[model samples]
Target: MYKNILAAVDGSSHGDAVVEAVASLAKLTGATVQVIHVRPSQVIGGAIASTVVPVEEREESQRVVDAAVARLRGDGVTADGEVDEGLREELAAILIERSEALGSDLIAVGPGHYSGISGLLHPSVSRGVAKISHVSVLLVRSES
Candidate 1:
């Protein structure tokens, strides 16, 4: 049984499935859920790009966290959320660090969305977390 559950969302279509899976698991285990949305920084014109995410993008990320938290609370599950910024490649490390900081016993995340050649090109955050995490991981596959 997990004491604390870390749920990672990217505001993608798979986000809902991740939240729902976390809710169900938390309800069963009586665990508190901490939802996180990581806003990936992009590289542009051979530059590392700005640290500050666009206002609109930040708002959207907050919305994603808020909605997930609300849905979990509405399900009578204890939950909270946070929005973080990091490079796309560092997403797994960020999630791992956050989860460790919060003492999360389990991490629930969406399935990797990439496929075929594109999948080979882009690293999957979910896969990375699963491979290196010290805690248990639940990959909630969405029907999208």
Candidate 2:
């Protein structure tokens, strides 16, 4: 019953399943879907080491998002994608902001690395967003 859905992703192997799950849900509900990738900001920048993601990362991100978009399109679903970079918490906030700006009704994210009780304590994107967002958030289990 959602009209607007935002799905955040990283190019992890788990992303394939997450995209599939999000696309399936969107298709079923006839909801518009937006795929997102947040490039991690450089926590420490120096000649020695930097947490900043390389520019090549965006190319890889595009590959992932393009594949996901094609899959959704193949299913006759409307989809779009965006790539941004910031801290993880900021990434989550960006997703929420975009969802609202785009008039999204729901946000979808995959389960965290933990399982069961630990997972709840960890509270992945879905859990965190649900608590923080003005819109509904869905937790999708990755088949990986």
Per-model TM-score on C-alpha atoms: 0.90, 0.78
How many residue pairs clash in model 2?
0
Candidate 1 residue lDDT tens string, 7-108: 999778798999988898889989999999987775444355434343238888999999999999999999999998887778899999999999999999
On the 0 to 100 scale, the lDDT of residue 17 in model 1 is 94
Top candidate by TM-score:
1
Best by lDDT: 1
Pairs of residues clashing in candidate 1: none
Q: So what's the TM-score on candidate 2?
A: 0.78
Candidate 1 error regions (>4 Å): 47-56, 116-118
